[model samples]
Target: MKIFLAQQNYHIGNFESNTEKICCAIDLAKKDGADLIVFSELSVCGYPPRDFLEFNDFINKCNEAIDIIRKHADTIGVIVGAPDRNTVKEGKDLFNAAYFLYNKEIKGIAHKTCLPTYDVFDEYRYFEPAYHWNVIEFKGKKLAITICEDIWNLGDNPLYRICPMDKLMEQQPDLMINISASPFDYTHEQDRKAIIKANVVKYKLPMFYCNGVGSQTEIVFDGASLVFDKNANLCGQLPMFQSKLEGFVLNDDGSIDGPIITQAKDVPDTDLNPIGLDEHLNIADIHDALVMGIKDYFGKMGFSKAILGSSGGIDSAVTLALACTALGSENVRAILMPSQYSTGHSVSDAEQLSKNLNNPYDIVPIKNIYDSFLSELKPIFKDLPFSLAEENIQSRSRGNLLMAIANKFGYILLNTSNKSELATGYGTLYGDMAGGIGVLGDCYKMQVYALAAYINRDKEIIPTNIITKAPSAELRPGQKDADSLPDYAILDKILYQYIERRQGPNEIKAQGFDAALVDRVLKMVNLNEYKRNQFCPIIRVSPKAFGVGRRVPIVGKYLS
Candidate 1:
């Protein structure tokens, strides 16, 4: 049997476009003489339709799309994911399901059993777990199909009690096929490959996995789909961060008729951890993910141009370089906002960066604007000492100038605040934090430096001075980040333990972190939840990003 995997980029709520893409792939697969073609989960209405799943009209549109797609499934078998209505009326109103279409009719349906509700997944909120399990038989091949999280229950300490593949084994299936819309993190590619290999080894059945590729807001789905032989040897794998349709020949002897694309390796024994500040670790993948995130965010939202305040700091330099790469250099504009405290080298460094990338830029000094705001507030505050108020005025003045230019030129402002600053509440609200999207919010300061190195790997894109200069906001005279916050080398580790690992203050301190420093960092993180809660949507590259995934209270007093 010949099978084709379609790793596609889907737009949420765009039924016409999604259906058109699906039908086009089906046509191509048929022309290539494929017996079965598979698409990722929720390919109909797009993955994580979120609250849009509640509307009856949304589900109706999804059903309408399925009807249109089934008409093209006459010659080849089609497997796609969508929400199926639950007439049983016992649990949730819908079941996340995979539809098997053959002979231009609904051949069979396999509902997803595991509804993941942790870290960026809220499937249990809108979907009901499958009450029954069965394998879909097509062309004399008994195919056991499951959704993304269904096969993830293979480890010793599994999240779900029932494994869908184990139940389907009752009928003695010949092959396994799983559809997924899994999001990308640095470590997820290896983790996904290991789990699929484990499932193949356990069931002794050749498995084919298809995953979606695209960025839906903060989440990025990397479509590196895989196919493994019955012996758990990886026969073929699709490319990452790309939309591809690849075909493979599966023989009746439980062997895939193709050279091994990669050798299966032992799975890592630890949970996904960002061990310290290793800059070179998975830096290339992170770079690609951020570029894709920027490209998709602008493309899907009908945005063509991007604008950002290009401070000479590492954060903004990396953001500007990435923006230029994603949305051609011509479309990305850089506004160099220099204040009274800004050094002459800072402006020159930013100018050199734009020149290196060949992107257009302008110099906009905010000293006069800062002075005007202070003039207006001097009457209210007669003799107040110089403090954060004066410093934030400069920062907000730059933000205002950038926004005004962005509004006049139809450009979306990109925020350049890194994760380290956001975690410690070191950023001023509506100042450096104002933008349409946060580029480096999920990346730590060390990670931003690493990205700068990667961007300059081939040629000197970012200036060397920008990479080596002492990091500062330039809000006050000679103000460095170390004035208020601890060193990034020490700070990022503690933040990773508390935020990503969910370690408490005591647990983090026990890892040789200073107890006083741990308490202070945790308090800063807890107290800054309110600030991060109101900030723009951050491009998530980490396991536990600050957006919809990590939920914390604004008024609660845990460590604060």
Candidate 2:
């Protein structure tokens, strides 16, 4: 038996583009004369569509994509994943499902028995569990097909409890197929291989595991497809986070041999360019992911474009640059909202940076907005002493403008906050926090600067002025970020240990930090959970991104 695996990289919510990529894979599989081809989970609309699935139009668009692939079902058989609606009375509205597609028909829906609800996953919030596990006899072979989390049968988690593998093996299926969106941690692939080995050995069957690649806001699926034989030995393996095709031939006894990796090449070591949050090793793959995230975020959310306040600082510069790269240059609007405290170099830097990035931007000069807010508040606190409230007002005013323009033109507002600033309470809630989505909320300020240098490694896209200029909010005269917070160098180091490493105050203090400094920093991080909870969606790059994965109670008294 000749089976082909499509390790595709899907862009979140970019159904039209993803469909074309899927079609290309199908054609390749057909040319190779493979009887069947398998794709990753949610290959139709991309995995973890998040709030996009909440929209009827987005779901309908995904259905449209499936129908498009269905037209060519006669030449190439496909096992694909998508959100399946249960036409039931008292069940969930959706189900994570896999479809056996051939001859322009959906043979059956293999519902996911395991719906993960831990950490970044919230499957229980949207899907109902499929109780039945049945074998599909296709092309002279009985097959067991499963969705992403179905293969991960451990833990007594809230979503589901049963492991169907033991029960499924009783039927003695010829082969098994798993469609997945399993993400990449440094150690994730090894664990997955162990799982596949154990399952194949247990069932004494040939199995194919196909997973998605590419980044969705805060989540990047690493496509590491694998094949295992009855002996628990890996017959073939596909590398992670790339678009590739693998073919495996089965012997008469259902024994599988080495995979012939096709339509892909080893990544050249010479190329290490700057890519976005969900970036892959390849340039095209990284570009595609960013474009899809931006396109889908806007398209799925009912917007055609977006607006961001670009301060010429690294954070805003990166945000604007990504928006321009994602949406077309004309679609992203940049406002250089300069207040009276804004430096001339900051203005020049923003304009130059905008021109270099080719984003459609303008100088709105928030001096007017800044003046109006202060004027209105002056009468209320006539005798009050000036404090952080005044600084926050400037930030709030700029945020208000960006939001108003977005509301008026149906543009999604983009937050320019970086992880360093967000780690502490440097962000002004209801001010700089007004964005619909935050592009770099998980990336530390230093890393943002590194990514900036990487993007400009070959060519200087980000000007030196923006990169070297003393980082500032410019909410007050002679204001620098260090005026209120520690230097980004020290702050990001502390944050990496505290947030990513999950180190407590004592543990961090053991690394030679002063007791007072450690306590103060940890207190800030702990106290800011409420603010982080209120923050917008942050892209997931690290293992502990600020999105769904790192959940903390707002009322918790757990001080590190």
Candidate 3:
């Protein structure tokens, strides 16, 4: 039997567009003479429809789309994911399910058994785990179908108590087909491949996995779908960050009719230590993910132009470069809002960087704006030393000017704050932290430097001076980030331990970080939850991003 895997980009709640894309893939697969075509999880209505799942109209539209898709299944078998109503009425209203349609009929339905609840996943809130399991017979072969997280229950210390594949194995299935909507993290690609291969090894069956692609707000689904032969050898893999449909032939002897791409390899035992400052990060993949994130966020939102403050710092430089790459250079506008403290070289560096990218830019000095604010606030302040208030005034002045220009030009403000600054409350609310979408809120300072280097890999797109210069807010004279925060090399590691690894102060200090500094950093993170809460949606590239993925109470005084 020839099976095709359709890796697609879906827009949440855009039922008409999503259904049309799915049906188009089905038609293309039929043209290729595919016996069955599999789509990623939640393809009908899109993944993590979140509260949309609660609305009866949303589910009805999903069913309506399914009805249309089933008509196409008259000539070829189709397996697609969508939310199914729960008639039992004992549990949740819906079940995340995969429907098998053949000969214009509902052949079988496989409800997802594992609904991931941790970090970035709130599936349990909407979906009820499958209470029963069964294999669907198709073309003289039994197919074991599981949703994204179902096959993830393999290793030690599995999250779910019941394994769906284990129950489906009872029917002695001949092939395993799992649909997924896994998001992109630098470490997840290898981890996903290992998990799928492990499942194929355990079940002793050929497996076809199709994953969703494109960015949904902050989460980026990278569709590097895979196919593993019964012997656990990787037969093929769809491209990452792309929408594709590829076919393969499954012979009766349980071997995929293709050259072995990779022999079955042992899953790496080494853990990706989030606490350590590793330089071997997959920067290329992160680059692609961020670009896709920007493109989709703009494209889906019907936004064409982007505006950002190019401070000549590494963060803004990288953000500008990425925006230029994603949305055309002409569409990204850079505003150089230089204050009194802003160095001359900083302005020149920003100008040169924009020139290199050929993006339009303007020089808007904030010194006059800063003086005006102080003049207005002098009656209230009387005689106080110039402090954080004055410093933030400069930052806020820049933010206001940028916003004003963005409003006038109909441009979305792309935030350039990095994760390290956001983690420790170094950013000012409604000032440097203001944006329509964050471009680097999930990346550490060191990662931002890495991205700068990656962007300059082909040529000097971002000026070397910008990449090598000392980091600063330029709000205060002679101020460096190190004045308020610890060295980023040290601070980022501690923040990673606390934020990503979930390591407490004691645990982080145990890893050789200074105990006092660890406590201080953790306190800043906890105290600044309010600041991050108000921030825009950050393009998530890490495993634990600060948006919906990492939830923390603003008033929680764990370390404060």
Candidate 4:
């Protein structure tokens, strides 16, 4: 039988668009002479609908979309994910379900068994776990179908007590299909491959996996779907960050029949070495993910133009370049607000960088604005020295000008604060942190430099001076970031341990970090939860980002 994987981008709660996209794919699969087509988890209403599932009207829209898709399945079998209402008086109101449609009717349904409640997921809040298991008998073969998190419960030390595949294998199915809406992280691609291979090896059956592509607000789905044969060979793999439809002929022996066919090119159907898919996480993937995140964040939100403060630093330069690429040079605008302490090259470098990208920009000198603020506050600050109060005025002045431009014209200010400064609370709130979206908030300062180098890999998109210059906020004369915080090389390691790894003060100090310095940095991160809580939504590319995934109480005193 022929199987087609519909790895497509989906919009959440957009029943009209989602129905149209799925029907188009179904038609394409029928024309390709395929017997079956598979879509990602919740392809009807999009994944992680969050609080939308609480509304019965929203679930009605999902059922309507499924009905639209079900009509087209008369010629070819369609497997798609949607939320189904539970008729029982007990348990949750809904079950994360997958519907199999063929011959203008519902053939089978598989409910997601494992509801992940950890970071970035609250599925248990909405979905009732599946207590029943069954296999669908299609033309000449039995099919074991599962949702996103169902098959994830298989491993040496599984998260769930029961493995759905183990129970399904008892039915002696000829093929296994997994519909997923897995989100993307830099290191997750390899993990995805490993899981698929492990399941195929464990069940000794070929698997067809399909995942959703495109960004859903802060979360991005990289649609690198796969087909693994019974021997654990990767017969077919889809592209990342885009929509793709590919067909495969599965033999009765639980192996793909021919060479893997993709929209771009064909992959040789040779014995797949397990190590072939183990690609190390690199900066290039991170760059592409960020660009996709920015593009989708704007496109999905109905934004056309973007504006940001171009400080001529590595973070701003990289953010500007990526935004230009995603939103077009004509659509992106820069506001260069230089202060009294701004170096001559800072303005010149920003101008030169704008020239390189061919993006429009305006120089709004904040010196006058800074003087106005200080002049008014001079009476109350008579005894205060030239300290953080004076320094913050320059930043806030720049912020005001950027916001005014964003408001007058239709533009969303892009924040350029890197993770290091954000972790330490070194940035002034409502100053550099003022933006509709934070571009590099999840990226570390050193990763910002790496992204700059990647942007200039083929041509000099970011000026060399900006990359080579010493980083600074330029709030005061001879100001440098190192004077306040530790070197980024040293600081990022501690942050990765504390924030990403969840290491405590003493545990981090065990990793060769100074006990005193570790406590100081960790305290700063803990004390600044209020600032982060107010910060705009960040584009997440790392394992742990500052947004909904990493939640900390703003007023609670943990380490502070």
Q: Which candidate is the best by lDDT?
A: 1
Q: Worst ten-residue run, lDDT, model 3?
A: 266-275
- Per-residue lDDT over 139-181 for candidate 1, one digit per residue giving the tens place of the 0 to 100 score: 9999999999999998779998999898999999999999999
After superposing candidate 1, which stretches have Cα over 4 Å from the reference?
Answer: 265-277
What Cα-based lDDT does every candidate model obtain? Answer: 0.92, 0.77, 0.91, 0.87
Candidate 2 colliding pairs: 218-539, 218-540
Models ranked on lDDT: 1, 3, 4, 2
Candidate 1 matches the true fold with a TM-score of 0.98
lDDT of 2 by residue, 105-185 (tens): 888778888888777888878888887788887878888888877766743442356777656767778888999888765
- Model 3 / residue 527 / CA error / Å: 1.4
Angstrom error of the Cα, residue 302, model 4: value is: 0.7
User: If both were scored by lDDT, which would come out higher, candidate 1 or candidate 4?
Assistant: 1
CA RMSD for every model? 1.2, 6.0, 1.2, 3.7
* TM-score to native of every candidate shown: 0.98, 0.77, 0.98, 0.95
